[model samples]
Target: MRAAKRRTSREVRTGNRFAVLRAMYALGTPTRQELAGATGLSFATIATMVTELLAVGVVTEASREDSGGGRPRSRLKVAAGRGLLVGVDATETYVHVDVFDLAMTRLVHHDHAVGEGTSDPDRMVGEIAEGVRSALAAAPDGDVLGVGVSLPGQVEPDSGVSLFAPGWGWKDVAAQALLEERLDLPVHVDNPLKATTVAELWFGHGRRVAHLVTVNLGTGIGAGIALDGQLVRGATNNAGEWGHTTLVMDGRPCRCGRDGCLEAYIGVPGLMAQFGERHPGHRYLEGGSQTHFLAAVREGLEADEPEAHELVELFGEQLGVGLANLINMVNPNLVVLTSWAARDLGRWLLPVAEARMRREAINGSAAVVDIVTSAVPTNPVSTGMAAFVLEGFLERVGLPSPTSAPLRRLAEA
Candidate 1:
């Protein structure tokens, strides 16, 4: 009974420490008094916890500011560089790696191109490993705790295997194990879109939104849905596979071997194909340069090509129509758009898409749904993957969760 009581006491103390740390971090640079107030802890408790954290270099004094015209109070923030995190983005065009500190700041990033339609899973994993090595070498410090990878395919959360990445022509590949063997570090893998959503929930708009959907429009379309502040990976861990949702019955064939899928219409190739059908005699999409296709379309429109504007409207309308179904069904507070189509052409696509969504949604769900581009800038997917590993490392130190056991092991070492 005495031992039980002691264990309970330790647990409570640990919980309180975590609560104080989270409050301090969320406030960015909160004073001891602010942390006490935010965490509902007594001043003495906050003082004790802060001192312990500061002594160990977990939290640092960021600045000093006068409080209410009185003596300057010390401002505290998380020590961003306490541990190193590595992230790999197994994308279609390139296998990108990003290194970050505990505070989710990218220290260095590099890209290694992989030829499109590379079917050999071993080759793909090798490229990702190379990127990881490059990132690790570039880090200011060499104490990398863990690795997180974002694949453009379905990844099983439990086993961390790449279920499928059509672009890579991979299926049921042991990506996590492959990476672990190469880097000898903890690894967490997930779909790129889902990884981005996880990052947003922890650091970006997630502070305000309890329910949100981030639609990634790249080689294929997929959504990362967070409902009630939890990233929902459905029964099969493919809950937000919005790209393959049916758009037009028996229309165009999609790369996923489906007819009239949304991805078939608005995917990089699909959009280019749609433009070609509308305008004809266009020498584009030949070399898989989606950027060139977009530039040409934009150029034609800039030169007052009515057909170009019409093509833009059609693309936006189709995308909006698809999103309207999602808004009506999910009733999300916000819809974040990513990828070149949504990122570069968002200003033009958003308005038109929102208008169409509002007009098409069954109820007034669209009226309340805010459509915007992702708040996370440049390499959002890779950055998010880095956050995945970094958060794991931080959580073991009583910061945030859900913690990665392997990451905890590496951090301890």
Candidate 2:
């Protein structure tokens, strides 16, 4: 019982330190009083944590902030050059890697294209490693703390094994182990659903809202759910597979081998299929590339082409049903539509979908839910994955105290 109590005490201190660090990152150079307000910790606790962080060089004092009638309080910021984090977003079509500082400022970017319709796990892993190496090459000198990869599927939380990737027909792929072997750095792997949701919670539309749902529409589809300002990962950490839910009985087939799935109608492939039905054998279909086809569609939509208008109207209707179902069921205060498809078409598609959603969702839920496109400045998936790497780094750092192993392991270097 004493051992357990000690363990619990260490965990609580670690959590409190992490909370302080996260608040510091988010608030820029904030005073101790401001951090206390942001993290809901007492001012005394914030001051103690800040002193420890400063002693270890994890944080540094900035210019003092003068109160109206009292002594000036010193501001604090994360030591930007302490370490580096690499984020990889590997989907069915491409691999994008970005290197970020401790403050989450992206410093290097690299991209590697996967072969059209490539599904072989080995080839995809190679592409991902190549992209990560390219980003690391351009990054400034620092110990690369870790690589956080956003893969496209349900990932086993404990082992970092990709349990399923329907698009690539992957099953039980040892993604994290393979990448760590190739890159010789610690790798943290997760699905894009969780990564993007974390990005939104930290820096995007969901930051201020307690209940939020992010609907990702890319080569695939899924939902990232957050309730009470915490990410909801169910048993097995696969709670947000809303794309597989049935939207229409006996409707179009989905890549997951299901009929009438929400993904079947709104994912990139689904939107491409709908576009093909309208303009079969059109010039945009020559390459059989969804990205190329969507680019053409975006151009057409910008010009207000009649066919594009018709296609968007249909797309809006289908997406509306998906959003309405999510809103009614989850009752999120904010619903952010994101990923390649939404990024490309959301300008024209969001209003239509929002109008349709209001009609379908419950009045109370619909009235409160604000549906908007993702506003994250950087790639949401990669940025969120990088956040994971930072979290891991701090976990190793632990809390600054005599009993705590402050500056041990990677933090010491």
Candidate 3:
């Protein structure tokens, strides 16, 4: 009973601290009274938390804001200089990096593309480490939380081993350990689709959504499923590999050695291939210009070109059918689309997809589901890498615990 009470007390204190932190983050520079009002905590509690925050350098007091015809109130603002965060997206063809400060303001970012026949794990890890160091050099301060990496595979929890990346033909790579050893920083690695879902929750549509499904429509298709405010990681932490699901009978070939997979029909490469076939003499294919291809397609779609419109409608219905499968399976409340194909074409395809999804969903489940398009600014996987670490940062005061990882003392570095 005494131990139980101690545990309860600790829970209350932790909850109170998070409430204060979140309120401060949301309100920008708000006074203690405002924080109390926003969080429904007592003045004393707010004062205690503010004192703790100030002592820990998480927040700083600012001069009173000018109030028209009223007494000015002193405000507390987050200390943007407190520390830094680094995020890395270890993608198939590139290593994208972003550095952020305590306030989550992006300070520096860059992309390093992997050349053809050069997607080896050692070289990619070196690129990521070099990218982080380059981004860190541009930061205004040296204090860093840690590095978070998003990769395209099933990741081992707390261990940076990528079990497999079928698309890249990579398996059993200790990316996290290699990075941590060289960079000497806390490195958290996760699947790109899962990281995207977490990023949506932290900074996009998933904030207000309890049950959501986020689809990534890019070079390769994938999804992340969240239910009851928690991401659903299958037994192997690869639950949302929906792209490989069979979509057509004996259709286009996929890299996964399968025919008729959703990825075979709807991903950017597949669509581009089909487009090339449609207009045999089109230069977009010969030039390999995805930008021009998308622009031409969008122009054709807006002009009501029969062929372009037919392609859009057919793919929209197919996507809708895919979503209908998800809806029927999980009945999520919101469906968010992101990535190159989704972001570029989702605006036009959403309505048609949603309509077909409604038509195909069983027992009117689609009525409760809301369809929307969203993306993390700049890069989702990279931003999500930081977001993954940020969620832990928010729950605590600052920096990862030394015991969390061997190379965890980033501030000292």
Candidate 4:
């Protein structure tokens, strides 16, 4: 009976160790005292866990800091080159794959286009798997902790299944399992917007900001909401579908079977369609149309072409109205607009949008929220994807102690 009790006690200790590790990963290096405070575990317990983690090379200690009043205290941080995390962004037109170190730095990145209207789930998975293999070949000799795939659709996180992605024509596919089987590593799958939001919260401008909204205006327009420091994923993990928000009662038909959605007005296809309608002679070279439009907008502003200026102003107005609704509803402290539209339009688009937002938002003071474009101009999505993987790693191993009030609350939940 004594032996049996010893075994049970050891099992409990092991479980507590895992819990503490997770807390540390989330906090990103905490002193022993801090770890204990965050995890709600005793100092003795944390010391034991930290010892074990250090023994296994999962964590390391930094130099001691002089406290001035007492013995110097040593800081602890997760070792940076210990492992790798994979990120995959499977979009309608292309598949972007990247590998990152524990610090969220991209080590390798590759992109390949997928044929339009291609709905073969198996083929898509195969292509992604190949990309992963290529990334692994380039990665340093560290163990891969996991692979995360971001899809532009509703995802059931628990099940790792994509419910529906009209853009990619995917439905009820177990993407996580497929990748896991192929890669033999832990797999996490989530909506692209949510994953991007997570990336921002941890590594981008959203860091340190409690409430923020990220608007990704690419082939499609989508919003990712972070409320009160937590991602607000609704019942179906589809809360931030701001693209389908109707701007006009019956203005224009959207691909999502809606009338006058923001996407119908601002999405890539929508913008091109509008341009085509107005300028019949305008021809787009392969993959050159978006660039040409941006050039036109730039030149038009300088040339004072009434037609081009009017088109851009209208685009900004519609975007501003939609953003105003979001600001009023979420009251976020920051709004990040990303994509070719925001990047290309630059200051030409923001002032007008800011004006409209000031007029329509609940808080007439637009000063409350800082609206900005993405800092990482090239491969923002891929960089964000890499950051997402880093976030998972940090959550599992680098956070503060679990006994602290803030960390305790997060752990308990």
* CA RMSD, predictions in order: 6.9, 5.9, 7.2, 7.2
User: Cα miss at 42, model 1 (Å)?
Assistant: 9.9
Tens-place lDDT per residue, model 4, 66-160, is 87899888888877787887888777667788887765667888777776566678887887888788878977888887788877767886798
Best by the TM-score measure:
2
The TM-score between candidate 4 and the true structure equals 0.78
Candidate 3 segments exceeding 4 Å error: 1-56, 59-77, 249-251, 287-308, 391-413
lDDT of 2 at 63: 87
User: Which parts of model 4 have CA positions greater than 4 angstroms off?
Assistant: 1-58, 284-310, 364-367, 376-413
Better of 1 and 4 by TM-score: 1
Alpha-carbon lDDT, every model: 0.75, 0.81, 0.74, 0.72
- The TM-scores of all predictions, comma-separated, are 0.82, 0.91, 0.78, 0.78
Better of 2 and 4 by TM-score: 2
Tens digit of per-residue lDDT, candidate 2, span 93-206: 889999998778899999877876788887788889989888888889998989999988799746989998998899999988988889999898988888888888777765
Worst window of 10 by summed lDDT in candidate 4: 399-408
Tens digits of lDDT, candidate 1, 138-230: 779657878988888688856978888777767888888988898798888888877878666655665466678889987789898877556
lDDT of 2 at 363: 98
Give the CA lDDT, 0 to 100, for residue 169 in model 3: 73
Model 2 lowest lDDT segment of ten:
403-412
Which has the higher TM-score value, candidate number 2 or candidate number 3?
A: 2
The TM-score measured for candidate 2 stands at 0.91
Compute the lDDT of residue 243 as modeled in candidate 1.
86
Tell me how candidate 4 scores on lDDT.
0.72
